[model samples]
Target: MATDQELELIHDPAYVNAVRLAGKGKLPKEKAGNFGIGTEDTPIFPGMHEASALLVGGTLQAVDYVMTGKSQHALNLGGGLHHGFRGKASGFCIYNDSSVAIKYLQEKYHARVLYVDTDAHHGDGVQWSFYDDPEVCTLSIHETGRYLFPGTGNINERGQGKGYGYSFNIPVDAFTEDDSWLESYTTAFTEIVEFFKPDVILTQNGADSHYFDPLTHLSATMRIYREIPRLAHKLAHQYCEGRWVAVGGGGYDIWRVVPRAWSMLWMEMSSNPTPTGPLSPEWLDTWQPDSPVTLPQSWDDPEGIYEPIPRRPEITEKNTLTVEKLLYPIRSNQSSSVKPT
Candidate 1:
């Protein structure tokens, strides 16, 4: 479990205490609104303090394994609660595990960290946590928060103070398909990793951008999920000497999307070949009855699973422009390196 001192790495002390009291019924529910508790998103449940701390603990343990050289890469599927703020919880997240882990990496190992977020919603809490810290560079690629929850993560929300240009956001348009989504992610990731050259990399892989997710509007397919980890794996080796920590986030379609997407991530981490063809009969039989939707038959989504999106050209063009803008600073630096004749 995460201790109060450890939690203070990112959360306020009073907010932490409030959660503890509220969990034990010492704090009144009516007063919990100020702390962002007892709401529809972050409901006040029994043992909430411990439950939240365990999520933090899972990510911290992943950090411990990587920092100690026990593992080159670590993953905690229960973590990546990036919407939790220093004093308040939102978006069903109580503690920002990635925020706390990034802070711990800086303090304990003195490592320069690169955080990549691919959740459908913006990672507002994590971005604001390290907004002015030069050592931590955060890159978030999400569906634009124009109408989404936590409404943030625009292209202009770079960094502040000494950390300017260190924080990058590329909010793609809704109805973004596999190719357009992957293009934004790959271009930004490649450029930023080369520019920052961080000592370690942490990725928040939220699978809610898929077409099946009920909460978000992005129309990404399983193809993007496969490529997401593939690029991260390759770059971690190239720049950070294989130091990578991955965590899960924002996958409400627990039956169909989350399992396959996350399984691919673990496969990439362990250097196993990506699976293809149909899923195991035993695996399907066990969960099929309880699943609300029909489980997929193969490792990849079938052809024509979603109808062709209308205005595809317009959406793709808009996303490409957003990526170019996000990478403008780096691109300009590259141009300056040309050295006039």
Candidate 2:
């Protein structure tokens, strides 16, 4: 677990104290409410501080492994609590591990960090944490928050001041399918990496965008998950010399989708072959009995996983517009022969 001092790298001291008190059930309900604890999203549970700190520590460990050349890439499935704020917890995240890890990277290694969040929700806290800092660039692609929680991540919500044009958000429409999602993701990621040339790439690989995920509205299948890691691994090697740290976020379907998506990520990172056809029967035999829903036998979701969306064309057009707008600033600079900072 991370030390309290380490958490202060991103979170406020006062907020840390409040969280500690609430975790031990010492803080009164009224007082905890001020810190955004005990609500439906961020409940005041025992050992909250320790649990949250452990999550942060896992990301820190990944950062250390990659930065120290002990590993080319590291994946922390417990990290990527991106909605946690400096002084407030939101969206069920008590601490923002990704923010703390990025700050740690900056302070310890003096590296330029590129944070890519692919969760179905906007990585609001991490974006805001480094919103005004040029050293850290955060790119998030998620379903539009107009009908989602946190209500942010608009295409025009670029960074401010010196950090302007660094924070990139591509909020696709609801019910967006695999092809459109990957198109936006691959295009933006390729362009941004070339523009920033970050020393290290930190990816928030949230699997909640799948159609089976209860928390999100996207219709993406397992194809995106397999392809997501492939691109990230390739780009990390190309731009950052293989320095990549991945963290998990907002995958609500822990049984079926999260396991498969996260396994594909690890497989890609470790240079193992992507499993196809049926999953290991041994693994299925162990987890299937406990799973509330039937687990898929194949590596990828079956064809026609969901009933066809009625507004597929409209959603695709709108998402394409958002991507174009998001890339306009970069494209404009290139066209005018102006270099990005």
Candidate 3:
């Protein structure tokens, strides 16, 4: 569905040619000089195009299932390579799977989609790609890009052209704990649900923000990480009539964190009431020598060294402030609606 639109989003014809070349079992080994396929993060692997096609295909599957009403919600815990641009494959991303899916949703389903990103890194590529079209409301809640990689999610980077205020970037204070993290999500997302009024919701839920993740510095815990997927499911039912798609973003702690956290997300997509059961010994056995840490029977892991889910004021403040700031603009222009998809 998105192959043609993806070529446009990935502006460079050369990169598009490369994608085609890779698809046909002909990838250049010298490197995709400026195409972002040869960088340290996204090295020029042999089947780079094929692997990317799989990711894009996974996201497209979610789009197809949701648009056709076969599934009210879909979550692909292996997609969401947000940093990749139309041409460049930065950050281990060959193709912008989320963008391709969004383009497909807009074209095929004719649905107004709201993309909610909760990864620690700013979703700069996705936001920039649709920075001018108000039909897609791209909202991101991340640690200030100032302190992070590809840093650029400032609050003022709202939208341009028809999309002026539709793009919302909620970069939070650094070194936050579970309370701060949970509050931030609930706060900003609630108002977004009210205003965007999307026909469907697509989310990039990166697990790297977890305290156990090695790539990021934010201190969100497993309890909070687990809640994000749950909340995405809830939001789908609440506003978008249960049309939702959630994809995995950046998470490097493959053994200790990614598997457990993503399991919670898959369970959410399947509407599992209690995903508290022990990890399958069968699954755990597969991880033995490569992953030294045995998969936890239970997915729950506390965030702080001591403090768990606290009813403290600092956390409350974080959540409240995030919601309030996001609403500040919407309130000023109550009549302004996101351009219809």
Candidate 4:
């Protein structure tokens, strides 16, 4: 578990104390809102601090494995609480593990980090934490905040001062299908890594963008999940010399979408051939009894699982435009630096 001091690397000391008190049921009810506790999204429960800190510790451990050369890659499926703030918690995230781990990477390893967040919601806390620091670059591709919670991550909210142009946000429109989603993610991630040339790559792999997820409106399938890790794995080797750490983020469809998505992630990370047949009967039998919905029989989502979207073309066009605009400055800078002799 992470020590209190370690958590304070990204969280405020007073706010960390508040979470501890709230976890033990010692916090005053009136003061709970000051720290964003006792809310519907992040209600205080017994051992909340320990639970949150344990996730942070998991991400830190992943960082250690990669930076120390014990492993080329590490994953903490419980980490990636990106909505956590320095002084508050939002969107059911108590402690921001990605933020804390990035800080740890910089302080301990002195690594220039590139953070890529693919959760359906914006990675607001992690972005804001390093918004003014040029050494850390944050890129988030999420459902447009116009209809989502913590409505931020617009293209205009680039970094500030010396960090300007380092923060990239591609807020794709709602109901975006697999093709558009992958286009945005693939293009932005590839270009950003080339520009930043980071020492290490940290990815927040939230599986909530699938059509089955209740919280988000995107219509991505298992195809995107398969490819997301494939690109991250490739780029880790190509750019960061195989230094990659991945963490979980927002996936509300735990029964069907999350398991398959995360399993594919691990398979790709470990260099296993992608499985294409029915899921294991033993695995299905273990969890099917408690699931309210029928679990998927296959590893990939069935074709036409959802109704055909009428706005598919428009949505794709808009998403393409957004990515183009977000990358315009970087592309411009790259072009201008070329010698024409």
- Index of the highest-lDDT prediction: 4
lDDT scores of the candidates, listed in order: 0.93, 0.93, 0.78, 0.95
- Residue pairs clashing in model 4 are none
Better of 3 and 4 by lDDT: 4
lDDT of 1 by residue, 1-341 (tens): 88888899999999999999989988887779999998999988889999999989999999999989999999999999999999998989988999999999999999999999999989899999999998999999999888788889999988999988899998999999999999999999999999999999999999999999999998988898889999999999999999999999999898999999999999999999878889989999999999989999988999898899998999999999999988999999988998798
**Each model's total of backbone clashes:** 0, 0, 1, 0
- Model 2 residue 318 distance off true place after TM-score fit, in angstroms: 1.2
Clashing pairs in 1: none
lDDT (tens digit, per residue) of candidate 3 on 233-261: 88889998899998999888888778777
In model 4, the runs with Cα more than 4 Å from the true position are none
RMSD values, in order shown: 0.9, 1.8, 4.3, 0.7
| Candidate rank order under lDDT | 4, 2, 1, 3
Q: lDDT by residue for model 2 over 163-201, one digit each (tens)? A: 998999999999999999999999999999988899999
Residue runs of model 2 more than 4 Å from their true location after superposition? 338-341
Q: Over 4 Å off in model 3, which ranges?
A: 1-11, 19-31, 294-297, 302-323, 335-341
